[model samples]
Target: MSARVSDATSRLKSRRDDRRRHRIVGGLVAALIVVVLAAGVYVVAFSPVLSTRQIQVSGLKVLAKNDVVATSGIVLGTPLARVDITAAADRLAAVPAVADVTVVRSWPNAVSIAIVERRARLAIATDNGYLLADATGVVFQTVSDRPGGLVLVDAPTNDQQLLVDVGTVYSALSPDTAARVDRVVASTRDAIELRLKDGDRVIWGSAEQSGLKSQVLDNLLAKSGTVFDVSAPGFPTYR
Candidate 1:
């Protein structure tokens, strides 16, 4: 009987020892996982291994790289993970000539910026100088002299809609048709006119049905008239 009791006691002690060993192993494993996570966080967030060491810029023609870098406000040696990319993008986008911009962190110590500059669609006379305008009728740059290869437009700077209307009319013209134009003049949306390089005048009524008007004008240009009127494409008249 004593032997049986001793055997039972030994079995219970062995089971307890096994359970203790499992708990100790589980605690060590949990501690190791915590230490690994902490090290990873420190390396990613605070360590200089992934800090900004260089800035790369592309798609620049007229804009200077230094100017763009200054505008970005990204300090060198900043943590790559903590770079304020949104703020940098916003600042660069506010520039009048920049149509679109992309800012991103290039892994392992670099920041990349891509810029899309606005293309000049027209030039308008401003009090300061000639203002280059894009297809959307937004004036971007002011130059001391007129820029070549752009159709000049005469309109009130305060009238945004009139500028947009003139832009619409110009945009509708085909490349061949647009090349013939020397300048555009508009007092209102309905009074837009195109002066051809050959000293001919076109009466463009408004921004409506500009595509049809362009087509009709192309067909009408073959005929002989100093003044071409295509305000109504269905019933065009020239005198």
Candidate 2:
């Protein structure tokens, strides 16, 4: 009876030891897995393997690629995950010629930049030369000579609203009529006018009803007149 009790106690102790061993082994494995995951995360987030190796610029025409890149403020060797895309894009958008910009991470080891440059629609005469203005009335650049395929704007002041009004009127004209326009003059927002290349003048009242005014002007040009007034398209006058 004593031997049997000892044997039973030994068996119970062995089972308890096995359970403890299993629990220890499981805890060690869990710790090892956690360490490996942390190491992997560190490698992906901070290691040089995922660092920015190249900057690819696209949709650039007027602005130099190098200049855009310089202004972007994106540094090589920066971790792709750490780059502030919005900040970079904002910096790029501040470029005078850039109308819109999109910055993104080309995964693995590269950054991609897409740019939409402003198109020069009009040239405002300035002391230095002609200041190029886009559709948004932003005078982005100046040139010593007049650029081709752009209308001239003659304003007493560089008023932003005047420029925008001129741009609106010019844009409203038909392609054929737009080509005939030599210069635009606007002393005030409501006193906008256009001078044709053939020495004809258009008395455009304001930016309002510009599309209707353009259509009326197109019809009136067929008549013999030096002065065409389409301030009110419903009551056009020519002489």
Candidate 3:
């Protein structure tokens, strides 16, 4: 009887130990599953591996949306954090129409891009092609928008430097004269010259003669077709 009792007790102890081992193993597996699930949830919810779904762009009339999108380098697979703002702006500016650009991050995984475009200021006739000048006087490129009989000017050595001064002279003309006039040639330093619709020419004389020049131009239209030199304020010359 003692031997049978001892055997029964031993068997009970072994069964208890087996149950305990199973419980430990089950707990460990459960912990591993929880950890894996948490990691997966975190990756799905907040990871930058996900593509940026929202893109907001402003100041984009002359520029095309697809062109801007392509230049941004922020495609469907591009992560929000991986985007290089400077590189994107540089790339966009390379498109020629873009003057300046600003890139900012939106909430979640969105990016916003703002662009400033260069407007066609003046048209010039080059030897091989046409020259396009912007409002700032910097020459862009030869474009097809050359209005008929529009006067083309000679590009100076420093095109950018000439743009501000010449643009000022171009803007200072009267509304009617400005509309009728086509090209202002930077023929010399002391003065700027304008080519009009007819055979008439207005000698600008000097940039200082802007207001006077505008008045002379307005008066010239009233008179017959002739060369009006507005270099002098009070005493204007006409041919």
Pick the TM-score winner. Answer: 1
What's model 2's TM-score? 0.83
How do the candidates rank by lDDT, highest first?
A: 1, 2, 3
Local distance difference test scores for all models: 0.91, 0.90, 0.72
- Cα lDDT tens digits, model 1, 160-205, are 8888888889889999999999999998889889999999999989
Model 2 worst lDDT run, 10 consecutive residues: 156-165
* Residue-by-residue lDDT tens digits, candidate 3, 1-239: 99999999999999999999999999999999999998866654557654478778899776788879888887754566666778887788787677788887675677889988877667766656666666545565665557554446664645555655676677687767877676687755566788777757888766776776787768766876578887786777777
Q: How do the residues 1-239 of candidate 2 rate in per-residue lDDT, one tens digit apiece?
A: 99999999999999999999999999999999999999888777899989999999999888898998889998999888888889999999898899999999999999999999999988999888898988656778889999988888998545887888888888899989988999998889999999999999999989999989999999999999999999989999999
TM-score of each: 0.88, 0.83, 0.59
How many collisions per candidate? Answer: 0, 0, 1
- In candidate 3, clashing pairs total 1
Query: Relative to the unseen true structure, what is the C-alpha lDDT of residue 227 in candidate 1, on a scale of 0 to 100?
Result: 95
Clashing pairs in 3: 137-163
